[model samples]
Target chain A: MFPSGHPERSAVERNGVEGSRDQTLKVPQRYSSTPLRSVRNDEKVSRHSSLCGLALGLVLIACAIPSAKAQDFLDHVDEALSFSALNGEVRARVSGTLDLEVYHFSGLSPGLIRTTNDTLFNPRLSLFLDAQLGPSVYLFTQTRVDRGFDPSDRGAQLRLDEYAVRVTPWEDGRFTLQAGQFSTVVGNWVPRHLSWENPFVNAPLPYENVTAIGDKSAPYYSFLGIGTPAEKYEHNPIIWGPSYATGVSVAGKIGQFDYAGEIKNASLSSRPESWPITRMDFANPTVSGRVGFRPNEMWTFGFSASEGAYLRPEAMSTLPFGRDPGDYHERLFGQDIGFAWHHWQLWAEFFEARFEVPGFTDADTFAYYLEAKYKFTPQFFGAVRWNQQFFGDVTNSYGGTAPWGRDLWRADLAVGYRFTAHTQLKLQYSFQHEKDGGNDSDHIFAAQFTVRF
Target chain B: MRCLVFCLCLLSALTRSAPAQGSVEGQVDLPRTKSAPVMTKRYEIVTTGGVLGTNPPLAVVYLEGSFPTSSNLPTKQVAQKDLAFVPALLPVQVGTKVEFPNLEKDTYHNIFSYSPAKRFDLGRYRPDEKPVPSQIFDVAGLVTLRCDIHEHMRGLILVLATPHFVVTDDSGHFRLKGLPAGHYTLKAWIDSRTTREHPIDLKSGSTLQVDFPATP
Candidate 1:
């Protein structure tokens, strides 16, 4: 991966380097680009909200039956009941998590955007329904209602983010086949992305930072350095958070090695509206996979790669005639490692992606983060993460190759305390700065209260 | 009639052997029901049950008043095996030195408790290490022990003020005998949050019958 101003810019391009542009101060239009696109985005949000309501309603109905005497039927399901009348094998359990978060970050800086209120607060809920059929088959789904799990979410809207069903052939979980809409398998963060698991409020730079590459249309590259930047915040990153694209996956643990592979309809950076199969097709499905090695219970290392079409079908008119959009794709490679010893837990990951923006040369970028958590006490803990993102070279409008975006790094410090086994409160503060920009307004303060039931 | 007369004579003689001490025996009225999940677990793999765990829903019965125990007592143990503390629930007298040994074949364990009764953090140790880690619980309160790594792993050490204590059997029955004649408070501890106590006048050589979850 090229580290910004490398002399061999053309060589990095040949080897698939990707560049990105970010504007933390610029406002992100929830529905971006032209006015027509914005209107469509609004409609899409309403449609998704309705769909989420229906799905959650179905999940609730499954927990009860129609009967005049069944007023409190669902609440009584604290224990799984195997009904002989129904083959005596069906047992179901419903559990959930509620997260209330408050965040305040300066929007008047070189980086730090995303809020309608000076002090913003929101509540997110995640419900899990698991039902076992006999000894080998099971059905499980996770439904979430969230207005951007964190402050990084562009707009304030609550919707279902993910749902999946998993199957295992044997009692021992050495093999599993999962289907439905689920998260990507390319990184180490997906497993602990939930509020109750992750200690931080904001995503890593790779997932949150916007690249000059846009999914809706041709990308706009900046001039040499950060001059003459893109006019709008219509850009994408190497990945937009945990890519919960609809797909099928197979994962298993054998001996000390674990492996997983996924085939999804949309690429990692596709917006939430395009995640559903009805909006996108598998003509050029994204294929991503990961292989991990665990020498022991204390340490794990993984390598992952993915290549797929990141452009949306609506952007077809923006490209030259007779060109297939899939030819210009997003290719990514990553490495992650985790170790837990005694009271210390550590994790680090490095990712580089190359986006072939239609008409323009490929954009190359790299992102990384190293985090460590210490258990200061049984009920309290402290964690810190060092994160940064750098862009390679891109041919600008003036016919010269230079970094298409600015580079930046951030340090996040967080502390958490568990009031009880089921409830915990986390507070975090971050210091961020661009390579040439000041950090006067780049400070971030956030807090989250999560309860699992 | 002759057999009944013989049984009465045997009971009378047994009472004379411990004339200076009283006893209490009872059955707890906690109904036998399936135990709900300890916490709301997300989509996870199958649970690998603990190697050593709590036996049936047992209760700890003890006297509540101060009763100084003898010094130079043996240190109690709560070993970490299969990523869990053996004997998930433990009851001990105040000042009992509790040892936490890592017994897993692989992986390390760090045993620590934030309970107000005994706040101690035994640093991490590899499996089967020499000299087990321990803490002498001097306070009379519930000490909840947990592994710093494995969040699901849990154990409890209930420290009592008096030396008279016994754990209930599978059928919820317990007997605490050989208590010096005195005015004492009898109590039952079901869990850290659930306990019932009642003042009692225990006379010499008398056996008092008690039942709980029935007005204390």
Candidate 2:
């Protein structure tokens, strides 16, 4: 659909045969001499002329409305006239990383299959486009193309990670409104989760390991065979909070406090095939927001929350006809803190999630991570991160079979050398352990090089 | 020979009919703090007290009035070398044109300023390319110069309406000479601090002594 006030055109028709004929082409002598034939030709010419005029008029209207609207908008919001010049600014940037890793997993026991131990290479490329449309309006989009060495999967995948239009109608950007698909504002790390911005190779547990409903592909859930009783007690995790969502957000800073809120599509039941929230089948929608306080330059603390229905489409369809969908709601709460002093930087986050599933006992989960980085020199730095997740006990109402909660934790140590502001080399080692009445552990070693222009 | 004789005659005439000019001299007293041990290898310009406590050389002293007529100074040049501005801070009269030339042969630089006094961006250009036009600072305020390509490179331009200004030396002493005897407002400024102003009266043929308390 076209924007408001734009000229709407359904279709335009032309007499293809007559329009394509040359002016020099003449009618048959018998028809040319007939008054009726001449009259018909004249009518056709008149009709064609009217169509041409209509087309010209439509084009003129289409071109004039946008410029007039823009001028009017600028006139009303004239405090930032200098920013209007920014409309002429356009920037396209590209950056990515190539990573090589070796993984070794052992100690699989008690109804769990052993994970494969192998070497793999993964490459990611990102493209960013930013443009200013007017003094108070701008557009930004970021896309990523990634390829991993998995013999069973496709060679590569491309995704549009973020596309947003931001408008600052007030002076000094004191108030902003953004609409479109964008990264969630639940935590600080999600905004800077790119390979170049992140200090470590992998994301925190809450962001990477949160098991969504019906997500059989999750590493932790892979052990549950199809049609197994354990599969019926799927629980929601905080992972969906950081994924991109299609919605509108309002964000601004008032004094030392900053706040943002968004209403987006409902959470996904499984990992999206291409992008997050491609469809919102249910009437339920998610609400996510964050509020932060920065009393000084070195420290900030924030609180975030999300609530909505997270049931898969198929699961929702199977519910009783009169059952209220709101009964299967998912809720999450998180707290984050960041501090930077001289050469040291510290970040931490804690998350708690609750899910209400039909025909099963409700589930609750908890996750948190702490990371710290020290700059040894202007170009070299070392970082360490610890992430852990604990799942709630699940009970099957039909069979009365319950599984105890599982706990997983990982520790990562990494060092990076930046050859320039736009290039870096990093090496990282990680150890992961899981405790759920079974033995599960893994070790990972990785190296990555990233460059940007 | 003609030029030499003209210069000598002019010198004698100026000496005979020279005005009785007064001078203002002042010492900036900075509070001393604990000093670090001498380093074997110094990377930055580390003063005895470092940047936080008591570096007096960072202050700029100037007189604000029309006692001395402002003159159009020649265009100044700030060179970009080793990813740093040669002179980190510079004070100049209003209407001065400043040229930023990249001295690194292999790299390109983009100089820009978003200061309220003046806003401009000279897009990226190579060192060997033809010289770009100089940026004119016509307003009276501080214009911060930066390189968009090199985030760490920073330069400051203090554009003042008055012509009489001097940076304090290492010894914390500054002298502004050739001032016609009159009452004027003396001002001292340090980075990220308030401006200190004092009313001073000067007599002809006399040197006035002023002491400016150091900023915390």
* Candidate achieving the largest DockQ: 1
Q: Candidate 2, A169: how far from true, in Å?
A: 1.4
In order, what lDDT does every prediction score?
0.67, 0.57
**Residue range A10-120, candidate 2, lDDT tens digits:** 100111112222322111111012232233566657755654554465344334433433433422222121221222333222223433222222221101111221233
Candidate with top TM-score is: 1
Report the poorest 10 consecutive residues by lDDT, candidate 2 chain A: A8-17
Candidate 1 displacement at residue B165 in angstroms: 1.6
lDDT of 2 by residue, B1-216 (tens): 999999999999987688768888888763332121111101010101111111123567888888443465788888887566767678888888888877874445667665567766665555655664478888988776766445435577888888788877766688989776778898876642347778989788898888788643
* iRMSD computed for candidate 2: 21.7
The local distance difference test score of model 1 is: 0.67
Show where candidate 1 strays beyond 4 Å: A1-95, A108-113, A116-119, A129-140, A149-156, A220-233, A396-399, A436-441, B1-22, B36-55, B79-85, B101-114, B119-133, B145-154, B197-208, B213-216
TM-score, cand. 2 vs. native: 0.53
Candidate 1: which docking quality band? incorrect
Worst 10 residues of 2 chain B by lDDT: B38-47
> What TM-score should be assigned to candidate 1?
0.75
TM-scores for all candidates: the values are 0.75, 0.53
